[model samples]
Target: MAGFLLILSLFIAPLGLSQEKVETIVNKLPERPWAVVEFVRGKVLFNGAKVLKGEKLRVDGSLEVSKRSFVKVKINGWDNTIVLGPRSAMELKLSAQKTGDISPAKYSLVKGACRWVRKKIEGQVEKGLGAVHTPNAAMGVRGTDFYLKVNPLLGETEIIVFDGEVEFTNELEVTDKKSLTSGQWGGVGGRYGQKIGEILNLSKAVLDKFGKKLNI
Candidate 1:
């Protein structure tokens, strides 16, 4: 019996040591910020308080841009950037998966317009960098530069892809989706059973107008 007990103790010792090593490694892991504010123009509020340049933003944070104001934020580690246009409100959320890996930066646009530009890193995959959810639609990024606008009152969302591609789907019906590429535009309406509109070529005039609005 004493020999059996000694054997059991020996077997348990490595398990405890392994657990301690794991805890030590986890504790030593560095904490990373979710995003950082790179620029601010006019009046901008983060979580109901005024925002300042170089501020670090965490998950579950909110941003509101007053009329004629703009704010620019860069996702830490990912190098992706988001710019909010006037009268825009957006919320940031983290994915359950680990950051800088399979996890994609998630955002919910409550209203107004915003632009997203994904920085292309050499040898990095172009997709799964970020996603945006609007009232009427959802967009999956593929290393793209795009502009999105939401009209809360009308329950509508407009999307224009300047470069790369965006996978757009109707929030109401996931099956109703389309891939928008450069020079393409689409939209979704919030009415009952509303679906994503047909993909259309964006005229240069429309691009100019949107560029002015987004200040891209």
Candidate 2:
């Protein structure tokens, strides 16, 4: 009975965390947070401070997660969410147009892994403006769900597109772009990137992991 109770407590602890569903807006440059940390675990840091649940993320700031930690945030003014994986460092830049609707999200993943999710815009499809920059390549995403990981030792960027498509391009060549559809994944490094093959289908275990991390 004691062992069972301990296991149940471990699973139930995270359920008690506050998951805020509200949106945050930034009217101008250097304004309030463009997003807020919806959930956090272990040692997550935002702009040098220890990140707390519900902490606002500044557009000009950066985030770092220690080993065994993760942080999820909801982007304001845009339909997207970002999950920073353990041992990762990321910087966020969000620009807003005069109409108050922000431009597509931009992120720089300096180290480690992260997941990106973009909700469908009002009428846009097939094309997206969100971009993520890694050491080896850049990714242009439409309304899609994707995962990216930067190998610190190999200097390679791994990408997996769960929904929609992502345009992967080598940072050295702006014209080089490869589109990866749902269930497709590949790697980018040394000035080139290629799609390996489609995954056919994602297992329930994989879906559950992403769903829990991003809260899609």
Candidate 3:
């Protein structure tokens, strides 16, 4: 009887330790932030508190931008940046294991517009991964520059791909998928099921203006 109890205790101890080990890894992930605020203009709030220029943001945290305000965040360990427009709120999910790894982040856009700019790394393609989730659509990032806007009052979501490509899918059903390449713009969440529209050439002035705002 005593021998059997000892054997059982040994087995149970290892199992308990392994379970705690797994939990430790998962808990540490929530503490990691995928991006940090590099520049902030006007009024910006992080987790309902005022955000400093160097504050790190984690997942599930609320980011709010007031009128005439904008925030620029630099993605950790990657040559990419994201800018949030005025009168916008979003829930962030940014975490990564290390630099150059597949770090998938998503911003749940509750309202207003945001832009992502991926600087080209010489001889390297696909350095980072991210997505923008609206009320009705999920926009996938594919190593490119793009903009997403969501109007909660009007129930509209718009996307513009300035460089590379972006794939959009119906958030609820996940069945409808549409791809848009450079110089393309489209909208989702309306009375009709809209798809990607014709490509419109983006002028240099427009690109230059966005570039200047991206204080990366």
Question: What TM-score against the true fold does each predicted structure earn?
Answer: 0.82, 0.69, 0.72
Question: In model 3, what is the error at residue 136, expressed in angstroms?
Answer: 0.9
Sort all candidates by TM-score, best to worst. Answer: 1, 3, 2
Residue lDDT tens for model 3, 1-216 = 356445555666666655455545444443334678989999999888998999877555888999999999887766778799889898886653433334567778899988877777767766336677888888775578888888888777877777888777777668777788877667766643454334456667775665454344
Tens-digit per-residue lDDT, 60-164, candidate 2: 778899998889988765667889888999987765332223355568899898889888877664434457888767888568888888886766787777787
Alpha-carbon lDDT of model 3:
0.73
Q: Give every collision pair in model 3.
A: 34-94
Residue-pair clashes per candidate: 0, 0, 1
**Top candidate by lDDT:** 1
**Winning model by TM-score:** 1
Report how far off residue 119 is in candidate 2 (Å). 1.9
Q: Which segments of candidate 1 are over 4 A away from where they belong?
A: 1-24, 27-33, 95-102, 190-193
Candidate 1 lDDT over residue span 1-216, tens digit each: 356445555677676655455555445554443878888999999888899999887756789999989999988777778899989999887544555434566799999989998867789766565679997689996688899989999888988898888899987888999999988988888542387767899899988777666654
Residue pair clashes in candidate 2: none
Clashing pairs for predicted structure model 1, backbone only = none
lDDT of candidate 1 at residue 100, scale 0 to 100: 46
Q: Which 10 consecutive positions of candidate 2 have the poorest summed lDDT? A: 18-27
Where does candidate 3 stray beyond 4 Å?
1-33, 95-103, 125-128, 191-216
Give all candidates' CA lDDT scores.
0.80, 0.70, 0.73
